[model samples]
Target: MKRVSCIDIGTNTALLLIADLDTQEGSIKPVFHKQTIIRLGKNVDEQKIIDHEAMQRLISCMTDYKHISKEHDVQQIIAAGTSALRDAKNRMEIIDEVVRACGIVIKTISGEEEAALTFSGAVAGMEELPETFSVIDIGGGSTEITMGNAQTITGSVSMNIGSVRLTERFFSSQPPSEEEFNAAKEEINRHLTEHLPPFFEAREHVYGVAGTLTTIAAVVSGLEQFDPEKIHNFRLTCEQVGNLLDMFRRQTLNEIMDSGIPEGRADVITMGALILHQFMKLLGTESIRVSIQGLRYGMAWKELQKLVSDGETTNSA
Candidate 1:
């Protein structure tokens, strides 16, 4: 019952999960979880830095996570940052501030590395995955697409089209009109056309991971509680996604928040739907299996293996 923790600081959200890993079973599962939505990249494009407002909020959350990790007697924490910090002009400044305030040094990883790690995590949890599968990781500020065989990753691409950026640039107005949604869809299609050729040319089963795809799972399942097991391997039809987009557009923001959906998720849910719809169209896949595991899970598993290996050497000596 040894515990480990991982912190994934993405553009739209900062997630922390501390799990009691039964590595003796060759699988990793989280017994405890904590997440905070600081929206770190709130205005990075305009400010050229992590916004001060968002940083303050993140500091508060990270400070709280620090306390929780200690209280739980957790050891070995790995932290990473995604698109926002990757593209920001003042990323180091923000990273310094985070380290200063919370004792967490966040690594801003490249999109390719993000794709590879996510693939490793997704593959680890699956009963069976296709030999020629495509894995897509959609985030707040970027998306990573990997083409892989059953054994290893073949090639990958990371694009800057993400839920938050797309929503901000195109669907800023709530309950976006058809014109707005189409414009965003067209842009997403254009980007996909330009960037996704190698992965899209030959596809088997496309696995989707991240909040966007999971929200689709949530909407389709209509579950008030977020259940990873139920959503994992769940598929949604293109027509179903399209229909939901249409219906979602008719509802106001207040209506969306008032529903069973969590308040922190309200702002980008529609935009996330739009992104996934376009991805399905471009891949010509009617449906995609939801991957509940991503970077946080990946980081934890990697660290756990290293720890167990080190422990074995110590015991032998």
Candidate 2:
């Protein structure tokens, strides 16, 4: 078994997952998981660049993750940067800085790859894996929806519409105006109608991942703080989602936070929630399963596959 640390640096947050990979069994046992909200994609949608402050936060967050990985004595550190990096004009410069200072290479992956990885991660370790399922990962700068099964993905699409992107575009105030809300909704609908693949239609089983879904699950379950145990595999239905959206529309950022939403998440939660709401409407599914494990976990499993393949190649050589 080899210990591997997988870090996912997203537009809104950075997550770390340290796991033990068994080459023989082709499985990964998670050791530790940590997430920090750095909003690395801050204003990337508008400015098309990762600003100075965002870069600083990225460096600092990676430094901390590096230290934590060392504490676990991991054999390999795999880091990935998603939509935030993909949109930022200075992404490579920021990634290089992380490599130089934190000694961690950050891979800026395409949206297609992100959706595939999300599908893999969402279904990992499921006791009763669905025959076929779709994964919707609502990120800060983009949303990835992929349809797949236990074996492979059939289709996937990564939309440029995300919570942070929409919030920044339309919302200048907490609890944005009704006009702003409708505009955001219209934009989301436009993206789905134009780009979403037909494979998603009639797919009953769906999994929701990333901060938006998990946070909504948390609030639905009435937890005082973030709890992964109660979150994983939790059911989020269409009715509940609609009610939540109505409640969010009535509440300001501070009010949302005071009601137990995670810091750095409450502000954008409404937009995120709206994305999920519209997505469910398009799919015609009553509910979706929530998955806390996402890109970071997917990266860990992919690394294990690579590690095992390399070992086989080495032995044959």
Candidate 3:
């Protein structure tokens, strides 16, 4: 078993997962996990920049994560950066500063890689997953849809539409005006119709990960705060998703937050929920099983595999 931490740095949040990866069991046992919203991709969609304040928030967050990892006595730290990092014009500079200050190296992954990693991680958490299944990971800046099984992936794609991106681009108010709502919907539709192909559509047994899905699950379960044990593996149906859309459709951000959703999520969740609603509608999906495990767990599994390989090489030498 190897004790390692995988940091999933996204457009809106930075999630940390520390786990004991057992090669023999092909399993990851969680030791610690944390999620922080820093909005790393705050204005990347509009300006293609990470900005100074965002960078400062990132460095400070990473520093805390570093101290936490040390407290847990983790052997390794793997920092994975997604959409925000992928589109940032000054990513390298931010990355260099992160290394200098926090001793963390941020590896920005492509959309395809993010999809595959998310798929692998989501399925790993489930007690029983189908031979053929797909996963949709909706983040702050991008959404990844991946179709695969236990062995290999058949199809995967990532789109540029996301909660924060849409919120910043179109949402002028909490619930947004009718025109703004229609405009956002149009943009979302264009991405889905143009980029997502026939193969990825009409998938059943879809697994969903990331903030958007989990927050919805929490709402469905009627919990004021997050409860991963209850939330994980929860089945969310099409009607439920639609109902959430209707519920949040008229509520302002403050109202949404008062309804129990966290501040980090309340503002953007309407857009996020809409993305899920539209995805399910277009794809003809009946339901999705929520998985709290995502990119970080996938990274943990990969790290374990590499560790096993390195050990074998050392023995041979």
Candidate 4:
């Protein structure tokens, strides 16, 4: 089968998906997907540029991805850059370097576009999208919230309150102190309150996507091997969120790292979870339905939909 790939380069991670696309009854499905943590935005918010080490790590990842695609005979690819790219001063230079080194073109999409694409991806497998479903895609550098119905969009907002960004901005501790955690949560809640009210009003279900949410789902389900099918659409209650947050608070970063989390994730998972917990509390939501689908899946599905609508075969460009 021919393959289509989507690469999402965010502040904290770089994700790659190579899928065999299928179109039947006006629906598209991805057959394969993979993700990695590159932490491109590691210290960008503080340093103001994609740091040298982070840039090199990213280049290596992209080079490997390009080679893998070639080995698989894959041709069609969509590469997108999010928050860090949007804010970096030397973004053009960074983009040029990636293209020269990896043979891949990267497009930096707007916040609204990110939210919409994520919403499309998250809702792709659902039988019916709610009239007022709030889809949240929380990244390392930013968070996107989209409120919409089955056929039309209502409002979309992207905020600069992600795991990496938040960790650097506040709670600079091995394990965040209660005072620090409370202060951090207050800041998040304050920032969110300004923009979230319009989006949260009359919302029915909250579908959370991206690394933070999925990681929480994985830990919650106690899955030895990550299973999206088993956890996607699974709800996490506020009480459950509080319990997990408390559990992580008791364990140090090294302990969590030693326990089982991927090394790259040990640093920021707690920060991400705390932010998520506050968001859920602010929205007065008891639970959130997980969506393994996100921006990369959304972008690929959009292109596939255009192809199918134009009555073209699932052929690669």
Best by lDDT: 3
Better of 1 and 3 by lDDT: 3
**Per-residue lDDT of model 3, residues 1-317, tens digit only:** 77888999999999999998776666688989999999999989999999999999999999999999999988899999999999998999999999999899999999999998888888885666677888889999999988878889988889999999999999989878889998999999988887556545438778999999999999988986788999999999989989988889799878898888898889999999999999888878888999999999889877877877776223210
Candidate 1: lDDT of 213?
A: 82
Model 3: how far is 4 from its true place, Å?
0.5
Query: Taking the tens digit of each residue's C-alpha lDDT, what string does model 4 give over 1-317?
Result: 23678888888778887876665445554655667778888778887788778878889988988877777667587899999988888888888999999878899999999999998888786886666888888899899988887787788889999988988888677588888888878888987888878876734588899888888888888887788788788887778878877777667889877655567777788888888888888888788899888898788878777767777665443
Provide TM-scores for the models. Answer: 0.91, 0.96, 0.95, 0.94
Clashing pairs in 4: 11-41
List where candidate 4 sits over 4 angstroms from the true fold.
314-317
The residue-by-residue lDDT of candidate 1 on 144-177, one tens digit each, is 8888865778888888888787778887677888
All predictions: root-mean-square deviation over Cα? Answer: 2.6, 2.5, 2.5, 2.0
How well does candidate 1 score on lDDT at residue 172?
Answer: 64
Q: How does model 3 fare in lDDT?
A: 0.89
Question: Candidate 2 lDDT (Cα, whole model)?
Answer: 0.88
lDDT of 2 by residue, 200-236 (tens): 6535889989999998999899998788989999999
Would you list the rank order by lDDT, best first? Answer: 3, 2, 4, 1
Which should have the higher lDDT, number 2 or number 4?
2
Local distance difference test, each candidate:
0.79, 0.88, 0.89, 0.81
Better of 1 and 2 by TM-score: 2
**Cα misplacement distance, residue 236 of candidate 2 (Å):** 0.7
